[model samples]
Target: MKKLGRLEFFWAILIVITLFNTFLGEQFASTALVSVLVSITVMYKGLVVIDYFMELKHANKNLRWLMRLYFIIFPSMIIATVFF
Candidate 1:
């Protein structure tokens, strides 16, 4: 059995999360809790993509920070709007 590479591992994780979210969405109860869980998963997937898929892990510090900031700020805004 071949070991999965970093990119492959992240892809698998993202797929699993997406499937889980779909199932969770179908139930459609506890919107706040669901939203929070989805937001966290999205942030995790985004960071994984940014670092590995986007090849930003060893890129310029400024560029990496900018992308990280976008991921953090965008989800934070969505979560804030949902709760407040």
Candidate 2:
């Protein structure tokens, strides 16, 4: 079997977190803490995808910053929607 690279490892972690989040969403009522945790997890998953899957790690500084900003802003919007 092929050994997992750092990117693969990160991907695995993302999957595990996603599953855990789903379980949490199903088992517990939607609360502020859950919303915040979900938002943070979404941001983390977005960063991993941007850096590894999108090949943005070595991308131009402006592009990298733009994507990072997008991820942050998008999740913030989601959390805001949940709260307000």
Candidate 3:
């Protein structure tokens, strides 16, 4: 058997999360809890893609942080929109 590389592992995790998100979206009727869970997963998926897929982990500190900030801000925006 072959070992999975870091990118492959992250990819698998993203897939699993995507499937879970789909399930949640289908099963739940857009409740507060479902919204929060979806937001969290989106943030996590954004962070993972930023760090690994975008290869920003070893880049400039400011740039990396800026990318990370998008994930946080957008998810918060989602929660805000859902609530208000």
Best candidate (score: TM-score): 3
For model 1, give the 10-residue run with minimal summed lDDT: 1-10
Q: How many backbone collisions does model 1 have?
A: 0
lDDT score at residue 28, model 1, on the 0-100 scale: 80
Q: Once superposed on the true structure, which residue ranges of model 1 sit more than 4 Å away at CA?
A: 1-4
Sorted by lDDT (best first), the order is 3, 2, 1
* Per-residue lDDT of 49 in model 1: 89
lDDT of 1 by residue, 33-79 (tens): 78888878888888888998888989998999999999998777767
Q: TM-score-based ranking, best first?
A: 3, 2, 1
Which tens-of-lDDT digit does each residue in 1-84 have in candidate 2?
243487689889899989989987999999888888899999999998998888898988899899999999988887897758
Q: How many pairs of residues collide in each model? A: 0, 0, 0
> Per-residue CA lDDT of candidate 3, range 1-84, in tens?
243488899999999999999999999898888889999999999999988899898878899999999899989887887767
Show model 3 residue runs off by greater than 4 Å: 1-4
**C-alpha RMSD for every candidate:** 2.3, 2.4, 2.3
lDDT of all predictions:
0.84, 0.88, 0.90
Query: Native-vs-model 2 lDDT?
Result: 0.88
